[model samples]
Target chain A: SQQGEEDPQALSIQEGENATMNCSYKTSINNLQWYRQNSGRGLVHLILIRSNEREKHSGRLRVTLDTSKKSSSLLITASRAADTASYFCATPRGKLIFGQGTTLQVKP
Target chain B: EPEVTQTPSHQVTQMGQEVILRCVPISNHLYFYWYRQILGQKVEFLVSFYNNEISEKSEIFDDQFSVERPDGSNFTLKIRSTKLEDSAMYFCASSEDSPNGYTFGSGTRLTVV
Candidate 1:
């Protein structure tokens, strides 16, 4: 499968703590995107990093990409209870293939 | 911000029956895609439509599957004969430019009994 693989299938942290998720894909990509999904809901786009860039930040979220390694990581700083959700990294080939996802639980 | 909308948020159907999931993608977007996630599995790409034609489709989108714009505002996915294994949350997404970002709908939960 050309799908990306995410590490630490799950993570738990206290409120105000930071949470990080990583993704590795086997093939070259045009861009990588991160999404967050609450239980039984659709995914919300978080951030997108191009092949040329190494890192990007949006609000409390930060994303980093390493093209040479074909891996990417997402960081949510000062995570809140509301940030508890499954996060997925999508790497684009002909179509976007998602990782198994990392389920993050923020304890309040 | 404009969001994609899907009708019949949840649908229950019998095996072998035809099921159609409808999506109204964000207006002005040029690319549309369909994806499905099983109860505990990763989201799998089903197909992508552009320029009134299927730009790319995964093997999962076999002969049993078909897509159509139907009218100016709606996009539809038709499963000719549904199977029990087809039960999953189906998501419809649209993006102004691809490999960039995407906006997704709440999703239609398909339950094939």
Candidate 2:
């Protein structure tokens, strides 16, 4: 499959804890993007890390990419109940191919 | 903040019927794309349009699928004849340029009964 694969299919954490999800792809990519989606809703773009960049941070969200490993990770620090969502990692080379997604459950 | 908007959050149609999913991408964006995700499946790229033409499309996008900007705004995806397999959430997205992040619409839930 020409798709990125995500690890730990699911993650559960308590409020104030940290959550991390990993994504691995088979091919080289120009950039990798992270998105969050509530059940049955459209996806919300969280962040994007280019091939040249190693890490990026947006408020509480942090993303790290390792081109050598063809993998990336998204970290949500001090997670909140509202942060509970299915997080997907996508590799965009012309078009974006998404992974099965990691369901993050933040318990209050 | 601006958002990508899709219409008819849910649509139910008979198999073999035609359905058009509409999306209004964020203004000032130059590229548009359509993607679909079946229940419990990963999101799959369908097609990408730019400069009034299709810049790229996937193998899944056969003759049955078509996309058009039809107007200045409104980017649309039309399934000529829907099938049971066509039941999925169709998402519309836009990006400013190459390697930029995409803004996606909530998606139009298409149910082929």
* First chain of candidate 1, TM-score: 0.97
The C-alpha lDDT values of all candidates are: 0.93, 0.92
Fnat value of model 1: 0.77
Cα deviation at B76, candidate 1, in Å, is: 0.2
Q: Residue B82 deviation, candidate 2, in Å? A: 0.7
Two-chain DockQ for model 2: 0.87
lDDT of 1 by residue, B68-104 (tens): 9998889999999999999999999988888676889
Ten contiguous residues minimizing lDDT sum, candidate 1 chain A? A90-99
Q: What is candidate 2's lDDT per residue for B1-113, written digit by digit as tens?
A: 99999998999999999899999988899999999999988899999999999999999999999999989899999999999999999999998885586999999999999
Error of 1 at B4 (Å): 0.4
